[model samples]
Target: MTTGIAARIADRIRHSGPVSVAAFMTEAMFDPREGYYATKNPIGAGEDFITAPSVSQMFGELIGLWCAQVWMDMGQPARFHLVELGPGTGQMMSDMVRAGRAVPGFLDAARITLIEASAALKMVQGRTLTPMGVEALWLDRLEDVPDGPAIIVGNEFLDCLAVRQAVKQDGHWHERMVGLDDDEDFTFVMGPRLGMDADLVPARLQDAPDGTLVEFRPGDRQLVDVLGRRFSDHPGRALFIDYGPAQSEPGDTFQALRGHEKTDPLAAPGTADLTARVDFEQLGALARAGGLDVDGPVEQGRWLKSLGLEMRAAALIRSAPEKKSVIARQVMRLTEPDQMGELFKVMTFSTPGLPKAPGFAPEA
Candidate 1:
């Protein structure tokens, strides 16, 4: 079935010509009337894809412990914001709250804030968190979260932010735009070449071969700036975990998924989950430029292991011996080098005076 959003996007392209990839993505994913996220639950058995939190409670619990430690590192502020970006179904937040409560005043001092754009997910989150006795306020953007001493966590969130793709041609870079193919389907077309002084292309990739595709997320950089400024202005810490490269690399990672399978990105707008790999290197640089102390863009496996994922799994397995194998599989899925462990990465930033977060070491 042709989704209404697909028709809407076609009409837009016909009227205004090709749109930037970022523009297309923003509409495809967040369009209020018929966007993918706006209309349905995009995670779980029959959904688009599943995240770590959906795979196991252990993931969120460890994050909770990490937050509690960060809270202690910050001297246990009397009132602090514990904000989560794109909290899907509120499962992770619920798990985090349960685990963090063990840290004496952690939960008592926390004011939970969730940054989510989907009204659909908000309803699901309400149902999931309310029964867990967790109270939270929601905002459509990160900036809306009242700022103070805060601990912000974003898991599998940054990749969803719209990213601009540029293709190198004749030794110069041109912006990639979404246009209609001969079949009247969405396709990537080259736009104007960027100026020599354009800040969009990373310096190292400027000399890339002709036809090289590079993707950058201006929105993600802006988000880092916002979060970094928040931490710099008011002491806080932020953690971002997502699947992407540790350093800037040349390749096209934009993709669409439906029913956990890859789909043609332009085939059916607003019906598939669209995303691109996040560049942690760019994000780290942005955070540093914004005056926050940056930490490792470490592999998720190493970071999680450092945070004691194995230990947590064992403790849980001991409690439910019969479920040992099941729990072990979940841990493996999260930390196995061949799985999410290597594919996903973890990075963090904190206020100048704050110490490095639990899973991160001092930068050399």
Candidate 2:
């Protein structure tokens, strides 16, 4: 039966014809009253899906240490911004804050900022961080963060940005839209052909045979543009960890997760976590164009190891010998090629004239 956001979306489509995939995703995920993120905290084992921070404290600790190193490279700014984008329940930030203590004055000289759109999740983050005496500044967009020397990090954040899909048909690319089927269920349909001047299809896919579907995020460009400008004027660095191929490829990566299982993205609007694979190559190019030095879209496993993942696991096991097996499993899950290690990628962006951030090797 039509209800909740599904009904709202159906009504909109019925009234105004088909909606682009980007518009559908924006409504289903960000609608103020009934959207998935607007209503619930979709992290942890009990929620839609688990993030790396929830998997282990080690992940967050390493990230914290990484930021500390960047802060040091920025000539130990007396005060700098330590920002996290889409901090889920504040687990990573909490861990990072704890780890930052190892670097004397690092936390003291830093201002904690979080870019979170969901009030529900913000409450959870508050609970997770308040005990540590961290009073964070929460904002709705990355652009809202105050300008200054900053160390920014985002884990599994880029994938949530809405993406538009275009399908090649009859040697022409048409924007994919969401429309109602015979059963009144949402379905994908081809819309108007993209004009050559406005075409954003990757050059490599220009001749892809008919029926090849491609996805692109307008938010990605806007985000990079903002960061490029920020880094151009300020000394700072940003790190992003997400799942996607290191190189750009054409495919439909849109899907929904509910209760840790994949579900039909169009089945229950605003009831599942919608995401698409990040295009790291594209992101890196944008960062470079924006005048920032870009680093490895490296495999997560390799990046973590370079930051001492195994060493941290050993230290944890020694402190709590009884939890050795559990710690070992977490290590494997975070670093093994078959698990998140290979699937997830890590990339960093830094202002020019600064050395490569921690965990990333010197560019050849």
Candidate 3:
């Protein structure tokens, strides 16, 4: 099926010129009109992808418990923002709030704010969170949230942010762009080589092999910088969990997803979900430079196990004996080394004086 967005992009190319991968992604995922998230729920078994929060109640509950600890660490701030970026259907927020009830004053002190761009998802989030007595204020961007001691959570959020890819051609780095072929199909084309900027190419990949693609996420960096600055100015911390390499590497991790499987990114512009891997190393560095204390980019499995996910599962199973196998499966999906445990990573940043967040302690 030919998508209107595909034709629209083609028209853009015919009028102007080839667009960067970042540009294509920006419009494809967030155009506000016929964009992927703007149109579809895009989560769960029927959607393009599934995030950690969607996997089980345990993920959200644990995150909530973590936030409660963070709140206490921040001296039990009288009023603080409990923010979640890209809060799909508000499952995480709801779970976190529910779990926060275990901690004294955590629930009462939290002012829920969800930074979600999609209106459709926002409606879903409203329905999901409202029942939990959460009066969540929705905003499109992080900057929109008023400043305060905020406990920020972003699960599977960074990967969707637009990223620019620089491809090496003839031993020089040129920006990669999306252009059309004779059949009007989209294909990658190289633009002008980069100028001499020490920061442009990471020192490790300066002599990268020809045709190698290295992605740079300016948007993600900027957001992290903003969050760091917020933490510096106000007193807060932010946690991020996503699938990506813990260290910087040279490769193109951009791809498209449709119906929970890989699809041609160029095949359907607005119909498929487009994403690139999160570069945790880069994000961590930016957060540190922006003035927040950085934490582990540890493997998700290890981190969760440290947080007692096994015990949490066991408790849930004990509560409902018949659901023991189901609960066990959820635990395995979240923490098994061969599953999300190894692929996904967890990291965080906070005000300088704050103690380390739970479940991310350094080795004893």
* Clashes per candidate (backbone, < 3 Å): 0, 0, 0
Worst 10 residues of 1 by lDDT: 195-204
Over the stretch 1-364, how does candidate 1's per-residue lDDT look in tens digits? Answer: 2888778878888998988889989999998978888888898877889999999998999999999999999999999999999999899999999899889999999999999888999999999999889889999988888868999999999999998989988878888899888988888898888675247776667688998999888887788778777876788988999999888999989999999999898778888899999888888888888888888799898888888899999999899999999999998999898989998999888899788789887431
Global local distance difference test of model 1: 0.88
Candidate 3 clash pair list: none
Model 2, span 317-353: residue lDDT tens = 9999999999999999999999999999999988898
Candidate 1: regions farther than 4 A off: 362-364
Per-residue lDDT over 55-99 for candidate 3, one digit per residue giving the tens place of the 0 to 100 score: 899999999998998888889999999999999988888888888
lDDT of 1 at 319: 94
Listed per candidate, the RMSD to the true structure in angstroms reads 1.6, 1.4, 1.5
lDDT per prediction?
0.88, 0.90, 0.87
Candidate 2 is scored at a TM of 0.97
Give the clashing pairs for model 1: none
Q: Between candidates 2 and 3, name the one with more favorable TM-score.
A: 2
Model 2 error, position 204 (Å): 2.8
Sorted on lDDT, best first, the list reads 2, 1, 3
Q: For each candidate, what TM-score against the reference? A: 0.97, 0.97, 0.96
Q: What are the runs in model 2 whose C-alpha is more than 4 Å off?
A: 196-198, 362-364
Where is the poorest 10-residue window by lDDT in model 3? Answer: 195-204
